[model samples]
Target: MLGIFGSARKTAAAMADTAYWQLIIDGVTSRLGPAEALCLPARGPSRNMWNWHSKRLHPYLPSLQEEFRRLAAYQAREAGYADPGQTRSMTAPGRGQFVVGDGAVPASPVRGPGSKTKSKKKHAREKKEPGSAESDGGSAATGGESPKVAEDEPQANPRRKDPGAGWHVEGGEEEDGGHRVFGPKFVLTSVRDDRPLSRIVLDVRYQRPGKGYGGEAALAVSMLMDAAARLPGLTGACWDGALREIHRDQLMKAGLLIVSPQHDGIAPRRIALVTGCPCGNRHDLWSKGGALREAESLDTGEIHLTPTTGSRLEPCGGRRHRWYLLTRLSCGNTHRERLDTTREDHRRGLNRTEHLRQHPPDTDSYIHCYRWRPDAESLNAQLDATLWNRRMIAYGAPQQTLVMLALAQNALTRHLHHRQAPSTTRQERAPP
Candidate 1:
């Protein structure tokens, strides 16, 4: 009986399809007596035949389809197939599994040229579970022997050829081939935080040909000082000279500090001292022969000095001298004063002084006694009035201008909107 069962099992293995083998097993089981103990192979091999045998067994079609799916899933797990939906295993033999195609496993344990032995050793060592005494301790079972220590410890500094023969150092020179000096040597005491707060010294000179104080030098200095005072963020205004002359007092009165350059030891802070010009000669006056004509009628027979060649006069060093001061003013109310001074100068010299007085020169005659002709002022006013009339005419025609302007604006807006609007219905429908 056992031999019969063994023969049946061998015959079942020889069959190509599992359903046929299962049928044969069922027939043999039915033939044996009911009392005889009977055993059968698991349903897996029989179920595998469902895919191939289902059409023939049409009465059980749905049941066979379910069994076919179940058998395919089981085979997929056993063969390590990733996708159960696929009928065949990716690891099927003779399917180029050994070749190193894209994402395929390497043919050998070696990686590249120098990787074979190291990779094998690493893999073998890793295969053993961690904390395994035999691998970690290197076979302690062999009389509990200690591992041999390496003869020489690995040196961190490897020996290399000395190309310079001790004559060179690494990074000896910078990229620009300059030696770097490291030290805090000369302290920059003047400038702090990279800002240049430097002292600029200027020298100013005054020269006058006339004996009495001509006031030109004082006026020039006052003008320069006034300009400086109008400058923004000006800290100091000073003059470096003696205060003996009356003009020096005038300079002091005009908000300028008078200090002796010799006595003031550089003023500790940044100093800019202005002095008189080195050359004593003033600019040539009366060069056009006007002053000579004016002095011709003077009764004094004593020779009168005039710049023109026609006047019989001796050269006298009594001409007026001019000196320009250099100072800075605050940015507040001083700016208003500067503007007022400029306006006054323009009104007196530009409009009024062009017309000379018809009266004879006398001791009491003053430069400001003359007035500008009424026609001059009236002409300027007419010109202003004409300009106002033209402006009014232009403004009154604003309706026509506005209509033209509106048309232009509307056209431009339409053009811009057309350019920016959606080009196609599909593009408009696309996700924003």
Candidate 2:
């Protein structure tokens, strides 16, 4: 049976037309579901199926992986896997299944000839800015005044200066002889389970390195939203730095990220219009006629919603593109303060070092979520382990096939274990 299964996988991976093999897999899965479908193999001398499956399904791998995860979750639920707490415990300080995601560089370790190295010339001595003195002796002519010394200021030690301070290179400008096999990058999503080091892959995507991780993260977030819908309560997701921009956009779109502490718990309720009256008479503000439109920040990052409230609430100046935070005073004087609607790559709550200092990484909701993102690496490791060789044995098998196979196994195990555990209401109950 083992030999047959391996042969079938190899044959399926190498096939020219993966549609036929996919059809067969679909038939098996439709009949048996994910857990069982993964166990059984098509009985035959399978040949060239792996390559066919990879090539055929490569284009649709992200969607296919998402669909498979949903199916696996459904199947696990149907099989008596009942862990509703994954979502419910989200409100707690440090609970919930960590949906950690990251991008991995799974390359074919084949190295080619040495890449050319370029030397960068330093232009620091070429020219000084207009305000700067030409030389230390010319400080008087340049209107340079002696530096004031503060009593509380710490003395700088010339001997203790950083050796590499003047030798630093500009970021992203350092020449890297690109990897010989800078193969297609892959994004993997997984959950941190208590059982072992291995993590269960929830979704996987393949993209060329240049495409970036933001778009891929958006897809993973969509998958997470689906899971959250199914499970409910708290579903925290952790993502690597590459997805920070897209992650923030998704959070803002889903109403997960909020600027105001009072409105943090409320979803889909942005401070549409903050109207402050000087008289301190509190009045509710409603969206009379504002269309959510895209706005660009000064830095060229895309902002999903323009701060403006449209003609109905447009300020007297007709600058309808600005978001305002209103300050209400006791005298009925309403003050409108412009609100920033710019999309930033960093999260205000999580990225602020001062905020992190107060909340700490473990206690901070966003920080805690992101800290677990490294678990996705364990999923990558598991994938490599399962793929037989360090790399994928078959073409197409790495992205979705191997991932789905691992997930199916995980779903089964989770279901079986949960099935035997006492029900929520009957926990610690005497055995029947």
Which candidate should be chosen as best, given TM-score against the real structure?
A: 2
Candidate 2 lDDT (Cα, 0 to 1): 0.40
Please provide, for model 1 over 342-398, each residue's C-alpha lDDT reduced to its tens digit, 9 standing for 90 to 100. Answer: 245455442111111111122111111111112222322322243212111111112
TM-score of 1: 0.13
RMSD of 1: 45.8
The candidate that wins on lDDT is 2
Candidate 2 per-residue lDDT, tens place, 72-174, comes to: 4554343333255533332232323445666554433222123232222112322445554643325566576544323333323333222111111111113
For each candidate in the order shown, give its overall lDDT on alpha carbons: 0.25, 0.40
Lowest summed-lDDT stretch of 10 residues in model 1?
Answer: 183-192
